[model samples]
Target: MSSDEEWSSGEDDSQPSKLVRKAREAPFVPIGLAGCLTLVAYGLYKIKDRGNQKLSVHLIHMRVAAQGFVVGAITIGVLYSMYTDYVNPTSSKPKK
Candidate 1:
């Protein structure tokens, strides 16, 4: 699959990932991603303007990888919590 196909967004014309299509899909995924990007930008700023300033080709992919990691982590966490709360029902109270 093409790069776009593999990472298509729900808001775009193309289809989104299955992880994003789930009922409990995080609405704030992009917001969390924005936070990652902001951190990356700040890192770039610090590395470029303040430190060694030597840019590397790998740094360009940092945004993509970090955002994916953030979204994936959140998705997994949500699914796990849903499973534990709804499917297993691990409360202290006894069932009537």
Candidate 2:
């Protein structure tokens, strides 16, 4: 089988994962990923100095940071879409 067929589940335009499609269309996905990685790295660095602290606590914070970044990116994308669609439409329409 070809690489495309292998990556996709079925013989359709829709890919196996929705995240892949969104990452292609949305610009914020890369930024969100970078932010998440930075937060996780920071968490790791902070945890390394404190051997007495529970690892689970630091892990939870990392998870929260990642989720928060994803949520924020989605929110910004939605708002920007709304603005382009309603507030400042770029498409030209004939007046009725």
Q: Which tens-of-lDDT digit does each residue in 7-95 have in candidate 2?
A: 54465445545667767678787778888888888888888775777889879978898889978987898888788789878652455
Where does candidate 2 stray beyond 4 Å? 1-24, 91-96
How many residue pairs clash in each candidate at the backbone level?
0, 0
| Number of the top-ranking candidate, with lDDT as the measure | 2
Q: State residue 34's C-alpha deviation in candidate 1, in Å.
A: 2.4
Writing each residue's lDDT as its tens digit, candidate 1 over 1-96 gives 766556546565334555566523454566566668776876676664544434664475565766776787678767766776788876623878
Looking at model 2, residue 73 earns an lDDT score of 83
CA lDDT, candidate 2, residue 57? 83
Q: lDDT, candidate 1, residue 71?
A: 81
The TM-score obtained by model 1 is 0.37
